[model samples]
Target chain A: MSNPSPALVRFQTQKSLAHRLTLATLTGRPVHISQIRPSSPTDPGLAPHEISFLRLLEAVTNGSHIEISYTGTTLVYRPGLITGSSPGSGASGGVIRHELPAGCTRGVSYFLVPLCLLAPFSKAPINVLFTGSGVITSATPTGDMSADSVRTAILPLYAQFGISNNIELRILRRSNVGAGGKGGAGEVHLVFGHQVRLPKTVHIMNPGRVKKIRGVAYCTGVSASNNARMIEEARGILNSMTGDTYIFSDVSSAAYLPSKDKSNPNQKRKTGVGFGLSLVAESSTGSLYSADLASPPAGGVPPEDIGRQCAYQLLESVSLGGAVSLAAATTVLTLMAMGSEDVGRLQLGRDVLGSETLICLARDLKAFGASGWGVRDANTGQEGDVVVSVVGRGVGNVGRKIA
Target chain B: MEKARRMHSTQKKYRISDFARLIYDESLAPAEVVRKWRGEDGMADLADDHGPEEAVEEDENFFRKAKHNDDDGNNNEDRLIPKYDYDTLAQKWSNPENLESLRQRFTTANLMKERNG
Candidate 1:
């Protein structure tokens, strides 16, 4: 292999750590991040989800190396080849089952989103089951969207790049946040059967008018009436705009997990007992805008507020006026940056471009030796839309290159 | 001392821009999500210069005032209810003139446009 020892990319703080690690894995570059919550008096290191994510990366890859400082404030990670679920490398029966500890506060989509970015370039098919107590399948107040939205909104974008076959995100069991917002006992299974050497370069500039709106209203361990109330309230606002609006309802019982009480060794308690709504609007040109809202863990607000607020959020996303919503710009742009050598063009709204996440992602891509993006005003019918042209690194699927 | 001063200056520089990231209000830093929309303040440059004629023409009489129907044998005559009811009454859009006022609205516009002519 050429360039055996590439220079390590240096970063600071825990901001956008997920994207940074994803970029490193995609480009096979090593990263050294410092000052991860250095000043938090009580908890000053990498959070629980971050550690679990590192373990997940190791499970899917062949030879990744992750080293943390003594206080856990600093980390040096050398990315390995994404072996996926091939035989003999920590995968049993062609599937890797990764468990999150009881203390994880993030929703499972927190891990699923970044891991999906790594799937297309893997050497083999990626199949992983995320289970255990910390797997909150619904969106939390932490801004990690629900798994339903991941299946509905985020996965469909891969089809534009031509990597959309046999991919599935099955929410085996639904769960919301448990008491005090710590964890939930949920289970999710993901299968990415399509592995590509290079994703097709895409030039998407048209954000057509949203023609149809679809949603999922789900409640666990709560009254089925909660789902109807959320659907009714959301539809009350959305139905007037788009005639082709339908919200499906899913009601399930809470997950029963074993309790840690020593006195009653056989104790079982129900966890993740709340309701949430995930709404998605699909444009005529296959663009998706999504909104997610769930009842808070403390449980005082009504389901109606969640529905109405989520409907307003969907309107806000549509009003952003771009080919990609703010929630999806990072994924689409990252895939564009890692595509074949030709430049791919994407039209983004002014607000999405000015967002801190996208700006930092562009900078990080340049730091990882990818070419700079060319930004110019798009002359599309929409106002204030800018076209970003990303020249790909042309380095994709090193495992395929070797094999 | 130098490190402390440098940290303070940098913090001041990036205070507002940092809030654009999608992070919940961690108990430590506590950034508030302001629900106060800019539309509530109206358009800044377009607020004072607008004429009153644009306001006078929005006669809420023609639209169907389909909010909170009352059974007290009274109706809001301000919204133009029609004289007679068809078998399939176009109760959808017509507010008649004879029905007495059922309730009063507290909006600023309601003060000027009283019950009926």
Candidate 2:
């Protein structure tokens, strides 16, 4: 291709690579990210997980060009058309599958979250299966980035923006990594149907109080009793908070195959079992928030502690009192900015205003030309809520194939 | 006067070079530079550095907040609910006032006056 125009945006450091990439893909803009931990003593530049994430991005788009400095401290990305499916492949009803053995560093949210933003605009249906140890781990010590969070929190938030149908997330296997366990080995499947109907406006000003709680306690390659014990303890805590509480016990063996035989699981098993708990609380207005905890393979944590910890995390999310959890705000803000041309409004907890993720999101949105944005404290002058407004850029899907 | 305003509007269009300079400028810290770009003076020329101490502090805060999640041991106890403390949390939830405050979230609760009965 002819030499393209210079990059339209530049940032130093390694913050929000996923956000920047997603924005660039949507706007067809080139971005240069530099000084990505250039001064760190040991193993600076892009982490292994980041390189894996970039591979996923390159797989989805056509003609995308990614240039990295030899030192790995700088990156320049020229986005190609978001050809959701491989070129020349007509839209097929069968789900398009992409699998990644995500290194045990970052959780699947690192990839799944951006997919949630891009899938709706894809030309064909897409299914992603991420396998690794840290698929559920979050940057937040107490927060979770599990597939359950995507189902309970992220999907529901997308629904408010008129993306209710054609999306599903399933946790096929649960693997616990880190202390008291083997290492991160789990499996999650996410399917996105083609066609995301953009909303004309979003006005979720009030997130009603949580009404009920539900959850899944899952175990793989571990004792079945582990799942039951976790559910029992977690319910003991949730029951006191609300009458409507239910936690399910799920035991599956498909996620524990040895890495050598992951594809053909008939091979000898070489790994130990894993166990974890995931919880979701639903508010009266249909908002959902979630949390999860996993036990290490060797020095296992008490099932009761895992249960209680997950429950407390759910309670903390509810107490934050927003239509969506702080973690889900990034997706919310991105969708709002990408919606049809009109003002979209969201009432979020004060924590979102101060969150580095949201701050970076605001900066990225400005870079994308959605400059007419504002944040105002709630009218009551209380710390309860903050109202955020942004004018959508009316970004439509250029990759959608004509039926 | 009209010509000047029109010229200023055209210049307001964002360019990658501007963002690069804003970030790489050694004199002003990154956060301060970001603030200026987001401030009312959208694209005004950068001001001279305000000493190294302030820049260092602002830069540290920016990176600290950004790395909050990545640092495994840097736990923000204030934000996390203590694990395994079910009894106290359960008791807190059982409070009558607490239950009442959240009652509106249930279907059995009365609808707002704005909605028709």
Candidate 3:
């Protein structure tokens, strides 16, 4: 094409009053046009209602709308393209079932648009919803009623599934549809979502998963008086986890202090941030002692001292979200990036998530105790309910690398 | 004599901040993952103190005593020591001049030679 004159180029660059009006008509909303020359001094903009009507007409002509009902409440939603009704909807009671018969054209001009507007905002309880008919009968360039009707029919279903929107869906200049004579149809896409929080008193089949990883601070001491100091430190740490703190003693100290190596400092000095690392320095206290974190003792002492306390507890893990072993010692590197200090020494093998590899570790940590694992996929970004069952308690058996 | 004195001073200067970084850096992995792993209260601070600058020499001496000499399976000294501290491993790690000696400090060949000798 020959280079256009500068005046013509400037004219093309400038949006005319008619172009502005058309855009307002298409948008279905009042648009404040500014900074450009008003083509005609007498032409103030189209009336707000008229502009809305024009946009709605364009939407019906080029796009489409779909009203869906589920469990008594009806929802009118629009999609980006004309696909089809969402899965499982077309087969049974769906948007199509709820709509009026196709032949009813009495309100095609005025009432149809009103119905389209009402479908989305309707709060009617819907037990069995069906697709409403006559959602897409509109004027088109080709003027083929049959073609327009089919486009209108398929477009709403697509919109319900999040495919299309606007009854007058426009096909762009380079659209893929061949021989663009009244061939433009909008597509819709849809997805359903629900959210439910766990009950305060959850009925977990096993309590092992219920045990949150605990944070503890302990200073070992032999004498009773010194043992008390350890309790103070442990209690301080535990208090930070949650106000409701408790202490229990098992004949086997291993449950509390997994690495109580009296000889190796690496093992003996197992100052952990998990469940308190404690030893019964004396036998006076007993086997079980619990403390409500919210209500600590007057002297900031652990409410109950079960036995010769070697350490005190402040916090514990309620869930083993995830854990992973990373290459290049990245576990520590990542934690450093997250900001250190808040996380202390990980219980040599405590499970954690959001850092390192969270996908499988959280599930495997479940296997550490009596509970079975619910392994989600390894790709952290992927979503869906994919919990695989592990065979047994997770110690000896190499955990299946669940994706 | 000057070198020995300088060495003694260098040893004394080994603050907890230095050793804190090493242990704290290592602690970061677990600390970051388990939000509660590091105590919400300043525990994460200690975890980050693993850098060499945070090492407290005196603290290390005491921590070493506590780690190596807990009174025969029962050290009941209620003396509070920060959970993590660096030990005076018999290497020249604290001083750059001593790095040459430190380089040979942990070599397998040197270890074998020492054992043979």
Candidate 4:
């Protein structure tokens, strides 16, 4: 808090902006990112969703400063303490209400996942209620997972880091993407009550056999039969592989959004009508792999297609054969890096390790002054599973350190 | 220590192989992972995969969950016990593709591939 004009970590491009910001927040560093969509001519600068995320960061944190250029092409951010819904910091009743403006195409997970990484380090319990027209709970074509997947697949992973208690991702109201993939009238509540001094250093080399499969088939503003059809098709494909499979059905009415027409501004219109599926396969050793698929807002594909494709996607994730799936790799690795000053090991599939996103994250960590990861081949039953050893930065929860 | 000492005094003999697990699959309880075929064009009935050894280590809850999959009684498609030919398994021991598929199937990949359909 005493440092003035801290050295800024310079980065280029809008790609992985959220993760870069997340790293900066965790490391208590300043960042200057330029050329955010500068190449695009028609509509340039930071996207709407990115701006929403920056606003969210400002809400959950205290004293964080952000400066965007006139064109929004260049930006500088000086991160502050993760206050997390404390009193007198724009939080009402221990809750930070973050609203997404209209024209946001990404799903709510785009915000929730990044916010989760920041929550554990916050000064107080983090409870954020996302209520807005732009919160698409369902998976979008943009590849963000459904809110259900974030709950079932991703949130449970915090337990491994000893940050498990009082964490809940409640989907108060569900909605799929509206027309033009712009918005959904959904309400989601995230409670991250546990703040730890340091995450437990872990060694997860064994990806045991997936023993059971649990999932949710949800339909909003559509016939409940859509859930049935999806479950049937998915179960049909997955049953023969392993008999222990159960998919729950959730049917909800469509979200009512205020009409945009100037003539009847008060009139409500039904929007974000769709169905989706989220499946999580849990291994005997507590490893989780998840898959999500939702019908497009344009609406033509049958529920069977979504179900079958999602089942295949789950199978594909399982086939990756690692202690961590690609979806959870970033979280697992980041937590490991923020852990105690010791080496933590995680076994990941070769493809998962070689993925561009993971590679970029490794480099970004290096830029943020974290130790390099040590990769060695795992001689386990599964072929090509590499064990990545990360030495922790030992700078976990700066607020917790002082308090 | 007491249990091992008492076991040592018994008439039964102990071996190192029994104490040492060769693989993670052998060490874990039988939760029944789906078999994935890795682009094998040949039809292989690799049912011994979840052989009698897994039957010994099977979780009762998992076994029960395996049995009661019927939302409706008409769903008789669940095979509680699958029948496999031990002869074919022995005959294919030397087959490279069978061994390769077995290795691939055990790990979590290429499950219920479209090749079968």
Question: Which candidate has the top score in lDDT?
Answer: 4
Q: Candidate 3: where are CA atoms >4 Å away? A: A1-221, A248-276, A279-374, A377-386, A391-403, B1-117
Q: Looking at model 3 chain B, which ten-residue stretch has the lowest summed lDDT?
A: B77-86
lDDT of 2 at A328: 76
- Per-candidate count of clashing residue pairs (backbone under 3 Å): 5, 9, 118, 4
lDDT of 3 by residue, A1-403 (tens): 0222111011111122222222222212223333231233543323222233333322322233323233212222222111122234232332322232332221121222222322221122112121122221222111111112222222232232122333442211110011122111111111111111110111111111112222122211122332344345445543433334343321111111223365764553211111112211100111111111111111233323321122221111111211211111122221111121122222111222222233222322322222332333332211211222223221110111110
Off by over 4 Å in 1: B1-117
Candidate 1 per-residue lDDT, tens place, A192-263, comes to 988888888999998877788899999999999999999898888776566788999999999888878989
TM-score of each: 0.79, 0.74, 0.16, 0.79
TM-score (C-alpha, index-matched) for candidate 2: 0.74
Candidate 2 falls in which docking quality class?
incorrect
Residues B1-117, model 1: lDDT tens digits? 343344334322222223232222222121111110111111112324645553342223112222222332123111100122221222211222201121110011143455353
Candidate 1 chain A worst ten-residue window by lDDT: A350-359
**Tens digits of per-residue lDDT for model 3 on B66-115?**
56633432121111111211122112223444432322211111446545
Which candidate order results from sorting by lDDT in descending order? Answer: 4, 1, 2, 3
Highest DockQ: give the candidate number.
2
What does the lDDT read for residue A263 in candidate 2? 80
DockQ of each: 0.02, 0.09, 0.01, 0.02
Clashing pairs in 2: A133-A184, A180-A296, A180-A297, A180-A299, A181-A296, A181-A297, A181-A298, A182-A297, A221-A273
Runs in model 4 deviating more than 4 A are A1-3, B1-117
lDDT values for all models: 0.77, 0.63, 0.24, 0.78
Error of 2 at A139 (Å): 11
